[model samples]
Target: MDQQGQNGLMRTFREPWRSRGALAYVVAALLTGFYVVLYWTEWLTPAAVALGLRSKWLLYGALYSVAMVGGAAYYLRHHGNSRYNRVRIAVNVGVQVALAFLLPLIMPLFGGPEAYLSYFWPLSYDKLWPSTLSSLPVYLALYFIVGSLLVAPLLAYRYGKRWYCSWVCGCGGLANTFGDPWRHLTASSTRSWRFEKVSVHTVMFVAVLTTFLLVLDAATDGATGTFHWLVAGGQWWSVKQLYGLVVGAILAGVVGVGFYPLFGPRLWCRNFCPMAAMLGLFQKLGRFRIAVKKDMCISCGNCTTYCEMGIDVRSYAQSNQSFTRAACVGCGMCAHVCPRGVLRLENAPREQADKARVRLPVVDL
Candidate 1:
């Protein structure tokens, strides 16, 4: 093709159906209506009649619906060269539609647990351990253990946190698509990173402490003493009707998501997600790294600008350093937006991560 023809083709690719924005809105409204029909009609009768309150599934259903439908609409409106977003959308819809919605509805027919698994608070390790100490059914314990421990660790070890954070998590799906336009608001400062570490770990500590106290309280149910009193009080504050239901639903879901426009896409994940923190610990030992090709970088700073996790991507690229941060969720926005193709997500051997690489001159390096 001639240079002018190539220029026209590039322009066409960049401008994707701008006049059809209204069509996205129309599709979103129809999808939401379909979700409402599924929920109200109770077509999935077994799931709608699960052990705990079935109304809770309504909330999960709503989140999944919006993330799947609305998130996709948003992406279609801005369609471009990033195949990553397309994959992310597919994974999000599959998780929300099949796993969160349909599976739960049908699982009850097969005698699954009454309570559904939440992305954040599904596993109560306190209830899972010492089977005789608590009245929690074996099936529920197996569910929590399998989801949080067995499945989570194996995936994080291989793919870093991307397996969940960027692909499957409803919270992260909402962030990546619904909160995408505001992702640049994420703070990329040393101070912010330090604060983020402290905040997220603090939440993780609270979750662990609360779970431990719940176990202790259950084990000493009939005992009476100072220790017992302490345990009881801790259980009341941490578990009785608070942390999982209130904090997880209201603070984490509502407020955390609400602040996306103001604080950036990952307000919850970066600052207060115990799940993200736990997964990050596993990710520190992960092999996947966003490797930088230093010679191709132009220092235009697009990568740094779009990093939803607030990573200083340009600095890593400048120094030929791959992202080693435990906080990285492997979203690949930094690579996707790089005009020069200076970054690629790849696995590096943990043992050889310290090995030397071929050097470029100071000017390019």
Candidate 2:
């Protein structure tokens, strides 16, 4: 194996845990079972009490932070030689520990609402709901509203979804860290890409529709009786409850983390995340792109293999096509693993990107 990429011949296929063997299945089963019990049952309540935690959620947060920290160590051990990888992973873990977990845990102690400051609407799902916003403190409500509607999209437009997906989102942090080992398992086939494009945007549309209905119900004071009942009337079959059960619990929790061993870390982000879908739209309209150097690619598969988002990076690199794909999370792994230094992540002006898209022969360079 050539020693050019950051990861050199991991023998991923030879390892049972990484290669979808029996151990991988077992791990997936355990993870699925854990989430099922956590979301649907109070089986873990006793364990949370024994740990002196107020609720199972806090206990889960502690465990989540620990997992990210442990996984970060493992990730850094393998990819830490690059300054970019080290800093990005460190900041990601820090955001998970501090903003996502600890701050929410500590806020209620000071007579404040327990809120995930790091999360915003669509992904947070309930953050934009009128009832949820009314329940929160005014500042926190504004934070979620403004952050979701303005700040988040603006950031995605300026810096790409990586600003959140790679550097701050707990989901992405966990994927990059704990899920790093099985990244090569992410299906990069054309069929998978087509499925991803359809499924992700469908979920995004559903999310927007759900939120719109909830707001309309609240605004009309339930005059839209059927819509109100169907959307948020506290019934199990209601849209809110169904979405929570299907999208939030089943997709995000159960299948997302649980299937990591078999399907790779980004099962949720790549195929189902409404937030990623929305951000990706803004990202495509923005500046972030992976610029490929002409005549430099060696056709090695490292970039495609390690892309958690299932992007066919080698195709773009080999063609010297400096481009932005809506699905790209801008994780920078393609550049990190490029043997010939053929790939670069950039936020250049649209004119420059347009110019670069015109292919040139090696002699012209």
Candidate 3:
């Protein structure tokens, strides 16, 4: 491309306020206002309860609506109309709508749960034993067997973390769309990366350990012994008070969203999300990767600048290496912002050891 073309392209990416990204911010703001009014007027209660919407549903709906619509609008305008982005928006909105409102309202009439449908939370490990002890085996089945054991591995194998983190998760959906602007806040330093690796994985380990103890306590029917000393009212204090109330409500609900301007949109996902850590474990063994073509790379740093996970994407591209970072949520911002189209997300064979190895591209949409 000519100098003029390169300059224009750079300007379009750098000054996103001059492009469709600004429109997304406007749409998000408008929708947020509408939602706030709906809640302030107490209209959300009727609209939601009448439709059998649970608390989770309200969150899911607002997030899905804003993220999908606004995100799609922005991507369609400036990101070359990729099929992946289009289908990602559609699937995210459709699935959230179904899970949040339609299914909960419809299924209960046929004798489902009186409050809400059973949606699995993959990293909610502490819930497993309580579920089994309460004889609500369904929760165990859904959260552990279906979500953690089955769906997670399948998705990791097929598409790394993209299936959940980018396309389906409410948290990820929020980050991808509403959090797009604040993505630059992600710390790109190697020290930050080291801290991220330790913190998130530590959370995952704690989750697993807590779950194991809870299950053990449940099995013994809460006998007062060494186990009690070890667990120490773990079921109520740890799971209910700490994990459910504190982590779920305060950390994820409040700090995660509220700290967007201060610490980037992915503060939770990048630092404290146990589910991400669990998925990243499987992702390390997955065939999927983002391959960088060094010949096409211009070292413009657009890829790294847009990387929400703080991976040095430009370095990877310059060195002709494939990105195998386990923390990658696969939001596609790096690939989308690349002017030279040097990077591609693909499934390389396991036998391919070299960082420069190329493979057939895979479009997640």
Candidate 4:
């Protein structure tokens, strides 16, 4: 344990991983580029190397597959440290955010006669056109693509979602990495269960409503994508503000969950996340989730204490109910922190005929 022994041990451990980072970049870039080609195949009039009009899931499956196998290989070889998925994280959010603001709508910020401004949203049929609104399927697929292909695995695979939010997500990482001073935003959650109930429910409803109205507006005119760019310098200004709002929400969670780990666990996940609200749907239908057994239960609140989403893990562990709650993020904090090996992660629930079988109390049958 002396400094010299520690130094020798560190040296021994550091050498084998000679810039795994660089190779990860190369691989993610190539894989992303391959998906891009797959995406553009519909427009490739010549039908060159046609993937032949497959199901959307097939394409997503391919993307997810590449990300998984590649991510797993990295996971097995690397420690589950911050360094493991840096490449994938950077490429994932980097490409998405850059395209979000820097594409056609970006106006030069320096030459403005009036105040400088920027745009955050995109244009109609210009870039990710379907984001504005179209068919229900396209509309539904909008955030699904953002979360599933982009966000989910980034959270689920190696390090977890906190890593994704903290490191890779440009907007998320900003408040997380630099806005510590503004940590007060999220810390304001109510301690009273009743108040927490009202506030969290209100926030969730409002977010969903705002999103719905915004989508309805865009879909109605086929112009929502084009609206932000109407004024030349307006978009980037909007982007600055929008990114702040997104970060503010994250701040709420971080302060509620990350900083105040002792007072309680993750406040945002339990109370505020609209995205988690949406993810919970798939989580209900999701092939994967966490599981628990009654015999191993210790009645300790360790899992509940650490949960960012704020479910009472100890309660579920004590009952016959499934652990895969709709709101569960599957962040694995509960699994990692469980001292008695009482909590576990697992798959989706199975469907049954007419009605799912339910056990009832005996009444002298």
Error of 1 at 298 (Å): 1.1
- Which candidate's lDDT is highest? 2
In angstroms, the error of model 3 at 317 is 0.8
lDDT of 1 by residue, 283-340 (tens): 8777777788757788877777777888888877887766666788788877876777
Clash pairs detected, candidate 3: none
**Weakest ten-residue segment in model 3 by summed lDDT:** 1-10
Q: What does candidate 4's lDDT look like per residue over 1-365, in tens digits? A: 23111112223213322223354345435534544454444443334325542344234333333443353343323222333233544443443334332331232243312101111111011112333224324434455446444555444333233333333333332322222122212222224334445655565455544444445545666355654343211453443234324434233433432332122233444455444444444455445546665578776655664454445666666663444555454545465446677766664344342025332221110
Error of 4 at 15 (Å): 36
Model 4: number of backbone collisions: 12
- Residue 40 miss distance in model 3 (angstroms): 16
Model 3 C-alpha lDDT per residue in residues 87-198, reported as the tens digit of each score: 7766765665666446655665776653222234434444355644365446534655566667777788778987888877767767766666567667778778878899
RMSD of candidates 1 onward, in order: 7.7, 3.7, 6.6, 15.9
Candidate of highest TM-score: 2
Better of 1 and 3 by TM-score: 3
Q: Tens-digit lDDT track for model 2 on 267-346?
A: 99999999999999999889888888989888877788788888878877778688888888888888887778888888
**Candidates by TM-score, descending order:** 2, 3, 1, 4
Of the candidates numbered 3 and 4, which has the greater TM-score value? 3
Better of 2 and 3 by TM-score: 2
TM-score of 1: 0.74
Query: Using Cα atoms with residue i matched to residue i, what is each candidate's TM-score against the true structure?
Result: 0.74, 0.95, 0.76, 0.41
